[model samples]
Target: METSWEEILEEVSKQIPPKYFTNFIAPLHFVRWEGNQMVVSAPSQIIKSHVEAKYANFLENAAYQIKGDSFRLVLLTDKEESTSHMKDAIENRFQNSEPELNSEYNFETYIVSDCNRLAFTAAKSICEHPGKYNPLYLFGPVGVGKTHLLHAIGNEIKKKDPWKTIRYVDSISFLNEFIFTVRQNNRDSLESFKMRYQSYNVLLFDDIQFLNGGAEKTQEEFFALFNFLYERKRQIVIASDRPSYELPLHDRLKSRFVHGLQADVKEHDLSLRKELLRSYTIQYNIPISEETLEWLAQNCDGDSRALIGIVNDLVLYKKAYQFFLLSDEKIREIANSRLQTNRKRIGFNPDQVIDLVCEKLNVARKDILGKSRKVDFILPRHLCMLLLHEILGLPKAQIGRIFSAQHTTVIHGITKIKEKFSEDKNLFDLYQSIKHQISFQ
Candidate 1:
């Protein structure tokens, strides 16, 4: 007897979380089985790629368990199936063709503020007038919207002129393609690789920092391609986690990167976080109150990704529980739980917290951990206790051990900082600043 798709999905659902199954797996439709291959259709290319990359193994395992044999999984989208032969021919001819731009990451969806204004403006300018910035360099910390801007540039340009050739690729993919081309050991293959990249009217490169770390041949090839694109007056956009000067590439490549406009997106501020949260709540239709949103914006640390993730979790939770309204206390509990989970993932130690407090407050380490009751020492000491308890999620007793004080004293110190956070603006700013530094570190 042949196993049905329903049976396979039922088996897979037991292994996957409910939310994941609903969001990713449920949208898939099993088409048919050919010999040892199981065919599936996804609603969109994004879903198809995500399932192939992430959940295909689970599906394969489930099918094996049900059928008592191993079967390969083949995923396709509706659009691909309509022109399968032609698509395959085109792919074979140009194996390194441009990838699909994420439609969700356009400029309109991107949140702009003082934090990312320069990069956003430069990216928009590139869309309006290609090759103007020549090679726009966008650098910032992780999850700070650099990649979004890269895709936005490509999407906007494509929207304006569908005829323009655009290629959006990361450094790793570029290196991998180059490596594959070289292994062919044919001059024609090498020339094809160069021509493919050079043919693009606009190139949006992401995570260029990955090109560092002894990929000298790749760097040389990239330098040659960079010169090709620049001399041809084609547009190029690059994003990295740090500035061009900080990348360990050849000086020539670094100089080329900086010759054009360079902009950076900083970490999200409180207002930015609130705006992001509001956007996400509206996007997902999560029935969160303004007060809860403010609390989340103030308490949730990290980049926009973190904020969006928490909102997603809330959406899932609301759906699972069938709750129409989330109370303030319940929201606080959820936020605290999320913070605790973040604490485990962040792996910040009490010592690092103490070091940051001392450095930021301009007090010596000994003074923080000592019996000093000076006015300056009090604020730093109190701030350190609050951070350890709130940011690190350290228990009062454990934090007390770090300071050689009783648990009650630790509680009092944290309470003092929380009280001052309401009354003292300077202290509140200092606390927020230190927290920001800790988050980036």
Candidate 2:
């Protein structure tokens, strides 16, 4: 008797956890059998890597139980499909499925600091009583906990009311799905899209600042859905790298975002970073001292993501080296190798940064101070501001005084240069040159 692929997967599910099955295995599609090999498809590369890393053993055991040990298993992402038939099959499989939110992003796991305390409290409050903080606007720099809190809100809401329809989407996914539906041109497909969104009791939209490119159409579509949800008192939460007013949307849309409980997650302070590092150390049961932990927290610039990465790397290094007692030298070596932790210690005054930029870009001190926005002077002026704030750690207000501009203007200049780094090679190279000189100075 021969067994089917579904039967093999069913056996595997019995051995694996339920959450793993639903979040990972359930979305997979068994594509085909190529000679003595079987190929499976996951919706995206992330899913493929996750399934391969965590579920390989269960899959192998299931395959052996169902068929003899002669068969080989292969996994591929939807984009990896070679044939049009496979592409169609994969597309159909991906349709009508919501992107899975990480179960790990619950309130229990989130570490609250003064930096994100208000955002955290507001998230909990909204979950306890939905729609009160309708359109809770969260804004922060990258790798801060904006997205984490967004998912946490969704997870908590679903836990409290299992029957409620909750959806979590980044603006990019929302934009892509809407564009796809519009292109389909089928009335039923468009209606299905409307029904899906309108049915959600809670919608967690992350990185709404990226909600540009197809500004008018997508913005209008989202604005309509937002209005529908808001009118019905369905909870809506949005996270972005900048405030709603800073987003490149119509004033109408921005006004809606501003009407909510707007909160900002600042960069983690030293105490908060120490708390986070200590929490991780305890979780892993690593035998590091308070002194080293404090030193680590003080050395880093309070970026939670970088601090967490260091913790992971330190643990791995400790295990590999089998060090009985970790030393300052060993930790510093690890920091140097893993993080470019050396550049941060070098100090230069804001005046030095301004002087360096002027020399490099062939601009004058008076020109930079004067109210001139010449093509030549603008780059140097922006670079001086950016370098002053980033390198010397000067306050934006202090940097603004150099150019006789408002603090907001200084911020805007830095932001524009940062965004241009991705698209303009000349601008990026100039930034790097200025940065290197400042770092070494």
Candidate 3:
């Protein structure tokens, strides 16, 4: 008797581990459903061998037990591996479900760095095994790879487990949705959102630090959501500019985040930057030089998106109508210009500086300018005062007046900054730039 395709799938799935079904068969391609036989395509020959060697008997026995021993499982690769249909499906689904995550932000395109490498590997780990890492947290500076990592993980998880439901959104977006859900106050809407979170095999929230208004209510709700999914062994991942502790999070909320595996993404180091530039060069079909890449890497710092932007600008700057021409000097100039422009743009006032320096250096603005001489706030406090004094060239007394301290206090700040200048060249450069930015006269 000829077995139907539906029967063939039903019997096969029953024999395979229910948990592994999504992990294994979802990646397997249902290439063609011809009469009596099903042509499946594995991702690679290795996958084909594993299925055949390990699971083939189970599959064959399933066919015989359910319907008949007539259906054959032919694992093909040539046609289905082309990725045209899969790519379209992924792109279309993204367009519908998560439009903000750019379709281009896939694992193939992400740049791995020491800062983000552990986090990258962890995300990949969870993608491979959904329940292993609960509430994956990754934090770093702006323009870092946090969002890229989230997108890459989403795309990869989708590819690895096509049958599994996945949800990825930024924390701010989630916050807005959460607020609306609260406003609606409908049991069904709330339940539906909760179900979506709980039922999703993988859930990723970007910029989780945005949860950081330290608002008791929002944090409470999110904490519940995180706990609920975490308990079920479902995957929960988040990305933020900084870790939970670094931000002013409530103690309860803070404990939930740090309890999970968290990694700080490193700034873009030289080698990773080179790899990133090379990838962009290929994407734009341009031929960039090693020298240019080195220069860009040295100057562009840790932001890969910024590097890509530099590449696009280089393409336009080249102005070659026929084809993309990558030049060494052009890439360098673009990178340097961007770095300088960005560095030159960080703005603040005396009050803002005092507030920030006080917090970062863990000192009070008053003590910073006061005669406390307490080394605790002394270094950073003095550093800020020195920056103001040197850059603004404010009279010691006038600058002291702003911080409500003696003119001698301002003088002391300037002296400390100079003393630390050689030991911390980068710090000095930063002070000079800050001075430059605030220079009105």
Candidate 4:
């Protein structure tokens, strides 16, 4: 008997989670088979690319399993173009396009918590009523879902009104493109570039902080674009590593950024972290016990990206070793190893260094900042000063303000710690241990 397409899909569905299947695979229609190739129809180019990248292998294997014969796979859009034509279609679509919005980063996949609820709500509001905020500015630290929300807004708007045009571009790309156009030194080239940006109904700009240093022309162009879109009441969304007020752009540009709504995303709390872990486990189809999930959530102390990374590592381990059940001990080992390998040593701030020193030395923060001259208080205080200066590269004057001391006092404290480190082996070991903890954190 010949195997039907339904049977092949059934086999493939067994391996993919239901949500993923519904989103990526259920929309696909099996077109007619041509010779030894199975042609499938995807609803859109985005869906076609995702399915081809992630599920093409599983789909091909499923067909082989059901039919007992090898066959090639070909995915086409609803247009049902031939393979040769599909290449041309894709090239044309991307010929002058900005970065495509990721289909996978819609609101449904974003884990909302108190930390990001405001930003999420604001983004949703913009979709429902475009240009209400004019420019919905989202600011947060790295890995805190700012970029995700930016893409989410664009995806939501595009979904609701397919006719609406949207463009997503980062500051660096915007700058590079402007420089390329300027080198042409042609009046028409610059005008064409301006028209391309102004044509979009919605513009999603990311990492606006990158525009801070020495991109005067790009900043001017962006300023003009901002005025053009705002005056026309077109929706614009922006994201950055810091708040708009902190951005070092021209006064006019900074004033424009503050003209609209500004939403901030904070780091995930413990409950939020656990929820994120659970969501990722489900998304990746990893079987993790509640206890293991809790432990991993508590131990991994960064943003959602770090937690998801740990779960992804576990998925790789499971596939590599074929481990049906992962022991808690094994999971911890994997989490620790992955954390060390991917840890960013310079990601800490002065406040974090101070807190770590106080925690390790059992010294009160008040005493560290106070005029305490006791041996115990003095040592911890000096350690904080040294770490802040050496590790963070903070100026001595800035360190003085943090410790409520003069610059000379700050310099003396740091020098004292260095001398202690050279003379005392135990103090050196303690410093190393604290530094290690900071890196892993």
* Winning model by TM-score: 2
RMSD of each: 16.0, 13.6, 19.3, 17.3
Q: Residues 1-441, candidate 4: write the lDDT tens digits.
A: 134899988998999999999999989988878889998889899999999999999999999998888888899898756554555554354445558899989999988888899999999999999998878999987998988898899899999999998999899888877886787589997888899899999999999999975988888899999999999999999999887877988887888877778898876656778899899888877877899888776556568877888898989998899988678788889988875565445778787788888888888888888897899999999998877755665655567788888766876787689779868999999998987776676
* Model 4 accuracy (lDDT, Cα): 0.84
Cα lDDT tens digits for candidate 1, 1-441: 245788999999999899999989999987778899998888999899888888999999999988888999999897766666564555474484457899999998998888899899999988888987789999988988898898889999999999999998999988878887787689998998999899999999999999986999999999999999999889999999988888989898899987789998876656778899999988887767888888787677568888888887788778899998767787778767776776644646788888878877788999889998998898899999888866676655567788999766875787688778878999899889888777666
Cα lDDT of all candidates, in order? Answer: 0.84, 0.79, 0.68, 0.84
Decide which is better by lDDT, 1 or 3. Answer: 1
Q: List the residue pairs that clash in candidate 4.
A: none
Better of 3 and 4 by lDDT: 4
Colliding residue pairs in candidate 2: none
lDDT of 3: 0.68
Q: Give the poorly placed runs of model 4, Cα more than 4 Å off.
A: 1-95, 340-441
TM values, all candidates: 0.63, 0.64, 0.56, 0.61
lDDT of 2 by residue, 290-334 (tens): 788776765555367877788777788888988765676787678
Which whole-number lDDT from 0 to 100 does residue 265 have in model 1?
82
Which ranges in model 2 have alpha carbons more than 4 Å from their true place? 1-96, 341-354, 357-441
In candidate 2, what residue range of length 10 has the lowest lDDT sum? 336-345
lDDT of 3 by residue, 1-441 (tens): 134445655676877787666666546656665576666777777778778777766665666666655667776664555654665564354335654446688776777766568878887787777777677888877876887888787788788778877787777767766666676568986776677667777778877767776556777878888888788887888787776776666777778776567877765656777788888878876686777666565555446777778777767766754445645665666667765555433355567666656665566667776667666766777777776544433334456667677644555566667768868888777666555545542
Candidate 4 displacement at residue 167 in angstroms: 0.3
Tell me the deviation in Å of residue 78 in model 1. 34
Candidate 3 global TM-score: 0.56
Candidate 1 vs candidate 4: which has greater lDDT?
1
